[model samples]
Target: MSPMTIDSPVAGTAPATGPAPAVRLRGLTKSFGANRVVDPLDLDIAQNEFFSILGPSGCGKTTLMRMITGFETPTAGSIELDGRNVDGVATRQRDLNMLFQSYALFPHLSVYENVAFELRVRRTPKREIDDRVRAALELVRLSAFADRKPAALSGGQRQRVALARAVVGRPAVVLLDEPLGALDQKLRKEMQFELKRMQREVGITFIYVTHDQEEALTMSDRIAVMSEGRIQQIGTPTEIYDTPASRFVAGFIGSCNLIDGVADAATGRFTIPGVGEVPVDEIPDAAPGTPLTLAVRPERVRVLPDGARTEGGVHLPATLTQRVFLGDEWISHLALDSGIVLSASVPSGDAARALAATADGARVTVSWHPSDSRVIPTGELA
Candidate 1:
């Protein structure tokens, strides 16, 4: 097989960054009969980087993680960890640990024993085991619960125990598969920060898998967005959200209004069947009449006040069809006279109040700058 090259804008993969990556996968693929779950996947994760594999269900993220963990052998490809090919290495022998959604603690064991399980199993000195166990518990803010059993801890506390156990061995990487999935929304949000802090303090690579976009956005240094057995894009959260490379990414990372049309290279405009003669700058380098899609985030769009005019942006006559107040902001649903529908987010306070006061069915205009929107091939939308 030829040398694998990851062409995406992955951080720390350039020639100037020396030495081996924390984890590398080349042509990684998994197939079951007629179905290919992960197809020709290649990736490089840097040491101490919080990398996340984000995709919706059935997108093969877990299978890919299993391949790295040695729990599931790849049908074809190679996995290298810190410069060593680990394709045939035993799961337990790999220098990494995995934490699952269920916490998976030993119910019969005390919290101290649970955190110390791996060390005890390996027959470490009793004195060293006690010291490490106490330190790990303190690291996770669970030292007070050391004598308690799994049944005596809260969901979040149990998760901390799992994290402590995963890092107690000082492994090269920590594989977290939806470790926050079992917690309530408030607790889940709280644990996101906790996990990030833990990973930083431990100074180990983290390969997290989750379908939740917010979780990936909040905690990852770099994210690999996957879909249909392949990576759609890989970049920082801001890069993925602000300058998505494809329609799927534009729509998936957060809410965005995707307007399908064909570009007019000569006029620097796009023509949609419902919305006519939309002026969009920075059009992708394509010949006139090429199919294109305009992507603009909801927050970037604005509902122009009565008789308000835009200086250098596109505007269309629209009607306020629905409005929702979300405390922190307001969502205004609109329909254009030409049949296009879109949404705009108004911040709370005066602006939201004004939009909220506007009667439904009132005429309005929605406008956005060309720079605030992205143009991509129309066929990229999922």
Candidate 2:
């Protein structure tokens, strides 16, 4: 296949001007025999941006990152780094570093030696290497542990040492492939903020690949959701979460309740087969009677006693089937009259306590404002 030019701007990224983007891909594609792992795609990552490639396993996210790092060759199209085409560049000469989930720290080497390994290989002057290594260690807050070996440090600290090594050379960009996947939950959360702080302090472009939705949302300046070798959506975390471009995005980014029904445009409502019509803030531009799907986040739903009045809000009859306590909040599961199950998240307070007091199978109503629900076309429900 020949390289194709991309005239339109990449999704969720501004058009490039002034200085070129930190990374650019035009019609980048990869295939192995009959299997296409990455379809032709266009994207631009700005300098100093914390970008994330998010998707489940086998969704081509890791393969795409490898192609960018020159570990895997693309079947077609081109890649540009800092406006320099690097289609055939060797991995080491790409002016970038990659940090893997495994610390990859030399167990026998001290933290300082491990961080100084790259410069030593390049025959960097001793004085310059010392200065850069100290700066990198200081940036990651590992200066005090410079003499410790990998086994002597905690998981988080070892990861920081690996991070210091990756950035010690001051590479133009860093590709992190689930670098925090090995840490404990609490340590993972701590390192998320630490990674963000290091990124800001160093001002280097970071392309993180992960399947954790919360992790991506917490650290990314922008995210590209991928599936079936294609980009499903690209936008800031708020845009991707609040205004998902497709049904896949809405359901994948967070916990959402999807309701399929036909749109009654004339009445500005959506009509579910047995649950009745519910008011919607904006009816899609399709003609009346068009099949559509409404997505509502669990937190937006409220569980109330049966026959409760819900003026100016959409409500549906349901039976409280189960309630789960999740430390900070409670998740109540309700079975709608139409056989659909909806979940409502309530903070651990009077409202949640009241809802939990209700017996299993108690009749109840679930309600939410029309503005909190998003409408999607039925055809895009995948």
Candidate 3:
């Protein structure tokens, strides 16, 4: 496919920003009657950034998007784009384009016409419209299929058409609400890179919305994890995954080992019940005998022989209960003396086979580095 030149943002309307964000929401909120679909929220997305809104169903991701797209007005707060306030602007006037999950392609129009529909509505000159549409099609690598109808193309192809339509207009930001939800697993994986590369080449800010945690992690430069009509945390995937600010974030984003224990302020350590006591990072605000929860990631937990010595953290006996072969890695469900299970992933063939043992009954010890664990206060702030 040939590389294409994308039109720059509208003159002065999409001003340059450094560390500053292209979009900002301050105390933004919306409601359908008494039901608060989207509670008061604050967020800032950097220029040319790939930011995703992720959460479980009914978590206000869609409502927030509606507010951003002008489909739904905020009941309170302010929204700004390119350092200008546009909280009450209409959808068409908001300098943004949304690619719907349904593709929403007009059956009567061919791919070329469907993509050029907006340009035609704006009364753009015929020659320029053709040039832009052709370039947009190439961005998604679907130039040859421009003459085909939505019904004539595969799900992935139709999605690219929808994406092409959105980018053809060169909106300030592209809003994708589960854009890849329609494609099959393999095709969806492929489209992830295609969409990301297209975003990079276009240099348009992307505000993506999805309920799939893995999808959000894979594509987003930064993510806002929402729940109960509010954003719980916002950070890069690595920061959110490695150092989740709250229990809700730690548990929701990925698999974690939660160990309940009590923190001793005087000695600055915690003793996990049915496990062992270990010194902890100094938590200045926590009182003595305060109960806490330790969140540990699977990769951070390792298995060892009965007498194997490691750096800090609790060590307890575990019985190999089940081993799952997951192509790239092997996930083992090990039952500990506390009746709680700890899962660890190793390479599929060699690394996993190195620890081969009797399933359901083999015994071993598990340990984690002291810094690998997080001592979260039981009473977390949301």
Candidate 4:
């Protein structure tokens, strides 16, 4: 793909120049026949922020996106854009554009016409329409293919044409609904960077929705993880990944080893069934026997020889059940004596080579620093 160029904001409109957020939801919600898809939700998306709504399928992310685009009316509360209430505003009246997984381009029209369709419908002057369409095409690096029909373009090219169409109007926010779902892995990765760059160059707020964790982590300035009609947590990628506020957020963002336990606040230790007491850095301000769920990322756990000292770490005796080689890291699956499972990640160098040389059923001790464990409410374990 050629380097995309974004010269200026859409022809007639200036960039969103404000300290106010681009979009805000106050008590926003939606329900269907007693099933609330999106519960009362409040979110503030800043101007030019590449915010992503990430969750599993049926997690209300799409419904939330629709509410933002005005396609779905909220059951209660208000939708605001640029600090102005947009209640009862029609979809077309909202300052936003939506791009879906499918490239909804007109097959009979050339790329140029497809991109210019919106301008024509709005009765924009012919000169302005011509200039905006060309500019959008160039921004996506599809200017050379402007004369081609949708059928003549590849899947990525077709999608870019759709992007051009949506962005030519210079909406305050662009809502993307798994827009890269139809592409292969390689193309999807390439488009992630391209989308981020296009967003930066155009200086438009992008609200991307995806189930792919890596995609959200790669492209978003911040992410909102949703589940069961509510947000689990909202934060930057590192914060979400490193310090998930809930069990759902920890497991959803990446692989984790969640152990059920009861904490002894006085001793700063948590006791797990089948495993011995585990060290906790700071005890929660709870009773001595408070039930807690401890979460540790797979990569945070260290594997050592069976007799290695476990000082300053929670130690568990285990036997390697399996090992899988990822390009950059090796995953060692271990089964604890208590029958619980744990996954430990070994970097793809000496440790990985050493583990690979060890027998599959060899004994090992898994340990993690007390600070590496995140303690959350035991209710999430249910």
Candidate 5:
């Protein structure tokens, strides 16, 4: 296999900044018998990009990663890396390394040996292998634990050994298959930063696969939201969260108050039965009376000063269903007369405390700006 060098990008080379994507998938498909695991997936990941493929269990996210890393063959289409085709390339031939979900470290082996395993298999020079292993260990802050058996290391340390093994290969791209799934919640959170730092230090393209939304949002430069063997949408974490393109993307990324409504392009608004006329930004393709879904992030709705509204947009008389203090914010769950229950996250400042003093089940007005709502485009999300 030809060697690919890894170097830290100079200043201004943040994630997603560069020339062509380090990896691109064109019309890729994979099937088992008649069941398609990955259905005609298309994606591009820029050089040194920390890209995540996120979805639920049956979403085929794992299958897509496998194809990219050459662990599983795609039934059709091509895998391109650095502008060259690699459809028939075996796993070892591709400049890729993987950190398995299980850590997959050789438990019986010493940490140093496990970290050096890849180099030994490839007949790397003994002196070079030692240097690489030590470097990799230091990169993961595990150099001090190098000689311990895998069994003797803590879960996080064992995880570092797996990561050390993968980066020791010095591959151009690294695939992390739910690398933090095994750690406890607090530990997993800590590892998220560690993994991102490792990627930056090594300057290799990282294609991390996970079903955890928070993990992806915290670590990725871009995310491909996958479901049912396909990618629903791909964008930066903020893009995916703030402006989800479809119903699925909106509903999937986080909590949403989805209302079934109808749209009239002439009026540029949704005509919900009980909620009444709600103005919208863009006139959707759907004609009047067409069944549509309206999405609003819970935090976008406002329960504010009495008589705050002067003009258009919907405001339903509501009652506070529940309220919870969530650190820096107070989460108020409101139940509207329109049968819509939504959460409003208000900053836990003086104003929020005053509002909290209002009686639970107290009547209030829930309002939203036109720009705050998204009319889920028909057919954009299945």
Candidate 6:
């Protein structure tokens, strides 16, 4: 409602330089009656960048995307497209296209006709429409199936046709809301790369929204993790996975073992209630006895034989409670004497075979490098 202004750069947003971003949000807010669906938010999606908004159901990801598309009016804040404010613009007038989970293809229309539908509605010249339709079909690798109807195509092919149609007009931005959700797992995985390739070839900005973490990680140039109608963190896949900004981000993005403890800056250690203190790389700038949470990825945890020699790492004794094989990798669940469970993932090979041979309830030692674990203030940004 107020004029959009940035007194300071929004956290995790790209620095304002070079060209204007494809999409920008300042103090964006949306609500239904007294309940807020999206909180005051600020974000910048760069031109031609593949950005994803990821969160669980009811986390406001869909609402946020709808606001950007002009379907839902924001209770506050402004939506900018290529640096132009479009707060009052109708959805059809915005320079963007959206693809939904449902292919939404006309059952009786041929693939070529589906891709040409938008251009036809715009009343483009016949020659231009033909060129664009062929190009769009070719881009999605559906040229050969141009004559096929949607009912005759595979789930993946129908999705491709939907994508071709969405991008046929060459809108500056394409918003995909879980477009691959209807496909089988294998097909969904395959489509992830296809979507990325299509975006790059078209050189169009893509704003993807999904609950699938792997989908976002594989296709997005950057990701915004959301929770409770607020953004938890924004960063590249590696940054979000390796150095999560909050406990929620750490646990939500991947399988992370979280341990609550108190920081002892003087000793450079974290003191767990039941388990003893463990070495930590750095301590937060908080007073002594401040609660902190240590986050360690399952792959980073090492399961060693009890009393095994460990150097320059935090080690604790535990019992091997369970081992689950996942083809390429094995997950070993170890329970500490304090009743805390930690999981270790090992590649399926000699080490994994050896771990599998270890009997359940056998004493084992779990160790991890201090550098591999991240410490954040407990309950901060959760």
**Model 1 Cα lDDT, one tens digit per residue, 1-382:** 0001111222343332467898999999999888999898889999999999888899898889889888899999999887677867777767777776455788999989988887876787899889888888988999999999999999999888888888887888888888899889999999999989988987999999998999999999999999978998999999988988888888889899998888877787788886688777768877777778899899999998755788897888899999988889999998988788899999998878888889999999888988888888766533
The ten-residue window of minimal lDDT in model 2 covers 1-10
Error of 4 at 56 (Å): 1.2
Q: Which candidate number would show the highest TM-score if scored against the true structure?
A: 6
Please list all clashing residue pairs in model 2, or write none if there are none: none
Q: Write the per-residue lDDT of candidate 2 for residues 73-173, one digit (tens) a residue.
A: 99999998877788777777676888865557889999999888878877889999899999989988999999999899998898888888888888888
Q: In order, what lDDT does every prediction score?
A: 0.84, 0.86, 0.80, 0.85, 0.81, 0.87
* True lDDT of residue 201, candidate 3: 97
TM-score for all models, in order of appearance: 0.92, 0.91, 0.91, 0.92, 0.91, 0.94
Expressed as tens digits, the lDDT of each residue in 266-360 for candidate 3 is 77777878866766675536667777788888877777766577766567788878878777877788787878788877675655776665355
Give the C-alpha lDDT of model 6. Answer: 0.87
The sequence of per-residue lDDT tens digits that candidate 5 reaches over residues 18-79 is: 47678989999999999988888778898999999889888897788778877788999998
Better of 1 and 6 by TM-score: 6
**What TM-score does candidate 3 reach?**
0.91
Clashing pairs in model 3, backbone N/Cα/C closer than 3 A: none
Runs with alpha carbons beyond 4 Å of true place in candidate 6: 1-18, 380-382
Q: Model 1 clash tally?
A: 0
In model 6, pairs of residues that clash are: none
As a whole number from 0 to 100, the lDDT of residue 356 in candidate 5 is 81
Candidate 3 lowest-lDDT run of ten: 1-10
On the 0 to 100 scale, the lDDT of residue 229 in model 4 is 83
Candidate 5, 164: how far from true, in Å? 1.1
